[model samples]
Target: MAQFYSAKRRVTTRQIITVNVTDLDPFGQGVARHEGKALFVPGLLPGETGEVTLTEEKRQFARGAVKKRLSDSPERVPPRCPHFGVCGGCQQQHASVSLQQQSKSQALSRLMKRDVDEVIAGPEWGYRRRARLSLAFSPRDQTLQMGFRKASSNELVDVHQCPILAPRLEALLAPLRACLSELETIRNPGHVELVLADNGPLLVLRHLAPLSAADRQKLERFSHSEGVALYLAAQSDTLEQVSGEAPWYTSDQLRLSFSPRDFIQVNDAVNQQMVARALTWLSVEPGERVLDLFCGMGNFTLPLAKRAQSVVGVEGVAALVAKGDYNARLNSLKNVTFFHENLEEDVTRQPWAKAGFDKVLLDPARAGAAGVMHHIVKLLPKRVVYVSCNPTTLARDSDALLAAGYQIRRLAMLDMFPHTGHLESMVLFVRE
Candidate 1:
């Protein structure tokens, strides 16, 4: 039945109605009732009355857009960014911080059918360490416009400042724009990435054409003056080090370095807390063998190695596996090792899978670890910890684990991203 619901649903004509919001959906939209159907209203909160236009109609539920707010909830607060309603980066800025966290916890608890042990939160603003801002040439103003896309629209929002960015990265927005304006070589620029790494700030410029020497000189001067590392990517795989060194960030005692195109958690504080919590929940002892699936660059592998006797980190990307090995050696952790293999496959026959891990840690991408659970069951790990970014997938995978004789022992909510609908959670399952 749940699988059927996950499949595509039919839609019909759009309608407009006044609704009294009763709850919030997983996407942070307000839920209301109309004609025996639940309607989802964007920009509306529970305990509020609003008029909405139904944008999508389905059998189970309907989706709508807020046309007017009749009565606002007490938890509503004015958004900090002037571009809040326009920028696509944030959705729940109008909601108070406490309300946002509460809604997320409630949503996750209901999905997992388990009580949340704790809610891990961090600073609500200026906590974003990474951002990708869209770039376009504005012919009307004869200037380059760089910002997030307009909410639900392809148009780019011209932004001079972003409050959600870290102080250092925020300070560079105007200067970066000024530099881009002066560069005639940059035409129809793809986008710009601002990453506030632990070492310093790094900017990745994506462009179609190769950069000229003059362009490189100008960018080099900008890097030196602003104290930022800059990289240019003509294509997805073609990343050129235009200036400065590759950026690196430290997780606990482990230092992991990567190219600008690589993936890294956007929030540093929450990531550290998550790592600490995961290790604590797993309780990897000195002599226990552990397996970390989808372990990118030893975020948890190196830290776990500090306590475990031998730790194996497996990932699909060979580059990340190499980086993880380097990070382990850089941290002087000899017990840690990494393997590059597709985790979705039957990895039980793999050499690393034969280690007979006593404990396991999984941190898969948004798709979640589906078929991998079968391979994991073969290892007969006593304890399993899952760190998930999507709740629906986590719930589906939990069923698989339960069938394999593992019961959920602990669950916690992670507010990795604030003022957004994004949800990340950690769950511990112990063999019964």
Candidate 2:
């Protein structure tokens, strides 16, 4: 079969080349040009002259890895993590903090075609409140490797500690590995979710098979000794809270409870700032109706309710919708309600969709809200605030809103994921 043979063609006379990087791409790779062909090298920064081993050749561009650096950029700094170059968790660790922000703002500005109004910065280190530690049994070594995946590869990095995680969570890495090692019954354990909730650290062990009583006793002992919450998710859609109090967090005059499996912002400080800025930009007024799409656990819905006459939160997940309802009642906000509606589908006929919201807030996932943007425009909301985790989708959606007679009023880039090439942005669009 044609597929049996390698699609790649081998090129002879390929040799290492020294190139001077001129710019950095969104993925934090250095951009270099040689013989009129573009080259991309990882761990190489702009204004740096580096030796690269050309790994692949394509029609237009080439890909390589930095072998040695002849000259370094002024913005280049030593990465704090020992596994910086290897771990996929962080990509821009070699760039200075200010440089990292500058690059991100530049990339976002170029995509949006508008000057960024503000840059919301947060703690440079130990700011991650939650993380998913990969688990794999290495038969070759007869040991378990618990850490993040290698950069551009599926192999585990076996990190002893992660500097980006909260201090409380970082302290549990060794202990977690030791605990897993002690559990003989846990063959092929899935993954461990570490959460640094406002209450404390919560450890969620996801397993493919059932745990033995002896294994449960050992986990219970570990949880008690460590004074952290523990949960088991043997089956999807089911979480058994084994021990400890429920974890919760407060933001923008509202408190919300969450489980380890629930989706929450990774950076707490930036989240607070983002929520505050979103409310400020929207400028919700009394007697005004607000609609929050993809409202997860009322993160923005509850806060928006404080200043508006009424707020309706829409989410696809029934569990999150229930959580939002509980949060509204927990905060004693009678004007707020939540509904379960698949945003990807046509929601124009839903009862809540006819509420005639004056303002709209969207915090969609990485796919962005293209599927709902046109329908939302039909509502004729005076102001729309879109929070995006992916810039490419945001750019595409911006075009959609512009076509619908909405003008970009303000834009801010949030460094929610510092030290990584990932970017988060908030855009305010007003009727033209």
Candidate 3:
């Protein structure tokens, strides 16, 4: 027989009830209840009394909005950014800074079904190290606009200044727009990446077609005068550095290296803090063996290698592995090595399968390394640190670890993407 609740269910209106939100949902929505049914209130905080109107009704839950705030949390403060709510970039802007951190912690606990603490917090603002923005140019109006998508639609939200960005990076929006309109035969400019280094900005433009000789020359001229290292996305998923001396670039401290297409954390300030937190949680001894999975350009691998006896970073892409090796050699890191192995796929048959390690660090993408987690649980290290961008998968894998006799020791929420609702969390476990 089929599952009892798997079939289609009717959609009907239910009695709308208003209650004080007391917690956060897995997706960072505020939690309230009416008639004992869970209500997800977006842009709300705990201890806030609000009037909620139900829009949809489901069996286990419903979604609602605050029509009015009857009372506010003592911790509440007005969001600093103007693009608050309209832009999909941040969700907790309506909440106070302290509550944003607490919401993330509570969300982790709710999702993972485990206890987590809030012992650590990263910088509040000016933390974003990298950002990607979508572009839209209207030929009829000869208009150029670049920003993120709106909250519930495919439309782009026009933003002149982002409160969370480094002031230097935010200052480039006007000049960049001026330069784009100078192009002769441009149809569409899909995206622009604002990569911030210690010196200044490295602007990466995603052009839908090849730039004419004149536009290319103009871009080069702008780079020379502006001190902005200009790069052009020659092909889809390809980044070619044009003005910078090196084909590959370095992070602010050069602690990590990245290619144009390779993924990097959005918030640089939070990233450094997160990496440090993982290293602290691991507590690497001088001779401890550690494995870094889904390691991108030795972000954590190199730092972990400094303390550990030997560290091996394995990635799916050979090019990234090569770059990681180069980064390790350039830094004169003697104990770190990198290998190309697809952690997304079943990696049980790899050459490093049997080797034992004292600790393991997982820095997978949004999909959350489920395949690797299965293989990793077998190795059974003394400690495991999971760096996750997605909480649902973290919860799923944490459940697996719990079944295998591991207890969560510490957890933290980093506000990597400030104005947006995106969450970054770190969890540590010790074998029970």
Alpha-carbon lDDT, every model: 0.87, 0.89, 0.77
Tens-place lDDT per residue, model 3, 288-325, is 89999998888888888888999989998788898899
lDDT score, candidate 3, position 412 = 79
- The candidate that wins on lDDT is 2
Please provide the root mean square deviation of candidate 1 (C-alpha atoms, Å). Answer: 4.0
lDDT tens digits, residues 87-155, model 1?
888889888888888888898999999888988888888999998988888778789898988877899
Q: Write the per-residue lDDT of candidate 2 for residues 169-193, one digit (tens) a residue.
A: 9999998899988787556778899
Clash count list over all predictions: 0, 0, 7
Error of 2 at 408 (Å): 1.1
RMSD of candidate 3 to true structure, Å = 4.1
**Worst 10-residue stretch by lDDT in candidate 3?**
1-10
Ranking by lDDT: 2, 1, 3
